[model samples]
Target: MEKTFLELISENQSILFKICNVYFREKVDKEDYHQELIIQLWKAFPDFKNTAKFSTWMYRVCINAAIDILRKDKKEIKKLVFQKSTYIIYLIMGLSPLEIRKDCLN
Candidate 1:
């Protein structure tokens, strides 16, 4: 299982590079981010249900990991930006705008 996972990851590894490039501007950060992404993939691999394409699943995991890292690294700015975007998503999904704003602010 580990070998197969590693092979699949290697094939789709470009996803990692693209995410790190986008979310990590510094070379050092990119290296760190790449390692974290691989860790996340390994942790989540066993739970993969195989309902989706491997690359698509890889994208979801990597993107989520990248966002998680950014959220931690840029707490204040990321919260504001992410909250506003999440607020819009909630609105589109029929959630009350007031509730969304209150939740985002808090």
Candidate 2:
């Protein structure tokens, strides 16, 4: 299971990179978010049912991890400026901020 998970994650690593790039600015914060994303993905791996594309699932997980970090740092969130591409992703994916926050925190 661990091997398979690692393989899947390796294939989808760009999802983590894109999310970290979108959600964080500073090098340290991006590094921290990358670690947090990997931990969350591992914790949630056992329940992955493969009903959806792994990349899509990974995108959700990455976003949720970012949101979790953002919620913890309200000041950082206020300072956040969503890039055009990030906004496009949100629009295209229909990832509502409220829904993400509720899903992430609970």
Question: Which is the leading candidate under lDDT?
Answer: 1
- What's the true lDDT of residue 59 in model 1? 94
**TM-score on alpha carbons, each prediction:** 0.69, 0.68
| Candidate 2 structure, TM-score to reference | 0.68
lDDT of 2 by residue, 1-106 (tens): 9999889999998899899999999999899889999999999888788899988988898898899888888865555644445556765778788765564477
lDDT (CA) per prediction: 0.90, 0.84
Clashing residue pairs for model 1: none
| Candidate 2: residue 70 Cα off by (Å) | 0.4
CA lDDT of 11 in candidate 1?
A: 97
| lDDT, model 1, position 82 | 88
Top-TM-score candidate index: 1
**Global lDDT of model 2:** 0.84
Name the runs in model 1 displaced over 4 angstroms.
76-106
Q: Write the per-residue lDDT of candidate 1 for residues 27-82, one digit (tens) a residue.
A: 99999889999999999999888889999999999999999998888887877898
- Return the lDDT, model 1, position 102: 78
